[model samples]
Target: MPLYKEIVCNENAKLYLWKITEEIEFFKHAVLLKDVSQKRVDAMKSESHQKGFLAVRMLLQHVGYTDFDLYYDAFGKPHLSDGKCISISHSHTFSAIAISDQPIGLDVEQVKEKVLKIASRFMDVSHLENLSDAEKMKKATVIWGIKESIFKIKNETGISFPKHIFEEEFNLESKKTIAQLQFNAKTENFNVVFDSVEEYIYVCAFEVDPNFLQ
Candidate 1:
């Protein structure tokens, strides 16, 4: 029940962060998960869910949702009976969820070197050309998060990066960034917000109503 922080992104959207100590029982009862995986169960054994159910349950709580009565679509996209659009992402000991009245996507990634090696696959040559040594790593990770968020929203995987998706760079000092996604025969776009946590980076993208798609 301990909320670490909350960010008011807009009148319609808000983000929250929670720190779970010995409150594992909170999730156990909240989700009604009888036989969660050992990894998840073990996370309860500790103060966190290391790739476990804690993340999901915490997310549910953040959105003021209590019903464990939920199911996943064919692509593993979580669906609620009320039809609220939601997306989730988790890393090591932390997890994040984004819920919105409109279609939204979210991703949390541990900043690591592996993202650098795969940058070329997801980032266009033009993007690579504009990066300096230090900027490249951060830029690549942001791109990965952007694509991941898009994939979650689309409910499909294996989408080619850089090739199929594109992002318009924003000054890190700015309040928002823009990401544009193009699939086989369709194109959509969103306004994204980026945040830098301790060792991880989080990105959220949602459609700009009346002018854009999510």
Candidate 2:
């Protein structure tokens, strides 16, 4: 499949998502991977993972970027050669990338009942109260995305989802929320935007700045 979804996040940021429907060989011939990325793809044990990896390159191409324009830091965080902040994520059949002038994080997670089973390990259980079983599962998945997205941006040592990141209570109907990362004796706020995409939750986090949400 081509671009599955695109969101103009702001004047300086955009998000792209791709649905993985092509065969491994199709993508292998469509995308040109660097030597290290080729080795990484070759080392993947699952065909699904390899497809997801290549699908991301397809998204990069959609935005007039090629694999050569991207690079990863020592912490595995992605960067653009032209000095743009970028975040990448993939889950199941979907792959996504977000580019911004400011620091950002993006995460895509398939909504599954399994997330509820381990909710307490990463989130405040009290926030799950007064909700139906279905809502519980959906909300839990969003919270998981919240933590994962924040971690992707910070990418710092000693950041624990359960111990350091906290989500402020918000109704799912709102389709938006706020969170905080309290780590290393510092606290930073983030503005969160999220929505469901065909049984999957897509979450994007932006650091609270003077121009944020303006």
Candidate 3:
């Protein structure tokens, strides 16, 4: 499929998803890549990774953008020539991009038992109590996505997922929650929204603005 899903995170941001069903040639024929991008894609050992990178470029075109408008920072975070914020993620069979006028984060993780296995390393286990096996897996994946999204927004080194990012207790039914990033002697809160697409959980986070709350 071309564009698998599109979610309007808010007035300023939107998430575009592409389900990876096409082969490498399909994406190569569908979009153009900058020379640097092409070289990076050429160096990928896995064809899946190459497809994911091209899928993101396909999404850029869907949003009226092309690879020419995109660039990466020293940290490998993506930036747009137009000054809009962009975050990219891909796992397994899915790839996504989030674009916004304000700083934002995006993550997509397939639900799996592995996340629950190492949940302690990145999150509080108390929040997972009393859920069925399936629920536990999904929730753990969501929390993981929350932390990842926040990290993208901060884009700073030495930030430990377990030590620095914390997700408040939230019901899966609510499909939203609050998270805190405590690092560098500062604490910051983010407004998080998440939803499940197919078997993957996608989350987007926007830094909380106290003035906007007022």
Candidate 4:
């Protein structure tokens, strides 16, 4: 199978994208299979999940981790034995993973019109205003990705939408944005970067620290 492009961010995070060209057998060997159910196992036959698993495994190996033991926390967030923070996402035919020394989040979405229907659920007035006519559809998906990343970092579920968690708008020319998470009455902000590939967009956000993996 051919691997898609891999990007290393300035904050010591590694992102890997994999193009789905192999059969389902590739997923059977994934490190994430420990607690997965037969139904989830059957679901991996879908190309998107397979590619996502491949990307995640690649990042796990790159970070000097082997032995695929993934378990969900009380809130349903995936956790690893090592303290390394990790996140995984998948779009139609592409999957991506992000790993860093600090907690991190990553998301991948296929550009689709359905994202527009639920924009209000996750976006605020200012975020909506910043989007242009051509970008309106994509804006919600991006927001969803940002929120997913935040949830992974926090390892908490049931967080509210953009009103509770805010992301600063940046021009498309600028590939990065800042987001703030307010939960349990405390707030913390972090930087997030995004990139556009063939038919999908990928996003990654994490805490800022100098000691990220080089």
For model 4, how does the per-residue alpha-carbon lDDT over 126-191 read when each residue is reduced to its tens digit? 565756755765666677777877777786656777657888776665777888888888888877
Q: Which ten residues in a row have the lowest lDDT in candidate 1?
A: 31-40
By lDDT, the best candidate is: 3
* All candidates: TM-score: 0.78, 0.96, 0.96, 0.80
- By lDDT, the better pick of 2 and 4 is 2
**Candidate 3: residue 178 Cα off by (Å):** 0.8
C-alpha positional error of residue 169 in candidate 4 after TM-score superposition, expressed in Å: 2.4
Q: How many clashing residue pairs are found in candidate 4? A: 0
Model 3, which residues run further than 4 Å from truth? 209-214
Worst 10 residues of 3 by lDDT: 205-214
Model 3 CA lDDT for position 92: 86
lDDT tens digits, residues 1-214, model 1?
A: 4555666654566665544453555565555443433344765554544433565665665566743545567778877668877776777656666667777788877778787787777686456566675556666677788888877777655577667778886555564677777876778877777777776777887885544323
* TM-score result, candidate 4: 0.80
Cα TM-score of candidate 2: 0.96
Error of 4 at 50 (Å): 5.0
Q: 3 or 4: which has the higher lDDT?
A: 3
The per-prediction CA RMSD against the true structure, in angstroms, equals 4.0, 1.4, 1.7, 3.9
- Report residue 117 deviation for candidate 3 (angstroms): 0.8
**Model 3 steric clash pairs:** none
Q: Which whole-number lDDT from 0 to 100 does residue 107 have in model 2?
A: 95
Q: Which portions of model 4 show Cα errors greater than 4 Å?
A: 26-51, 58-64, 67-71, 130-132, 209-214
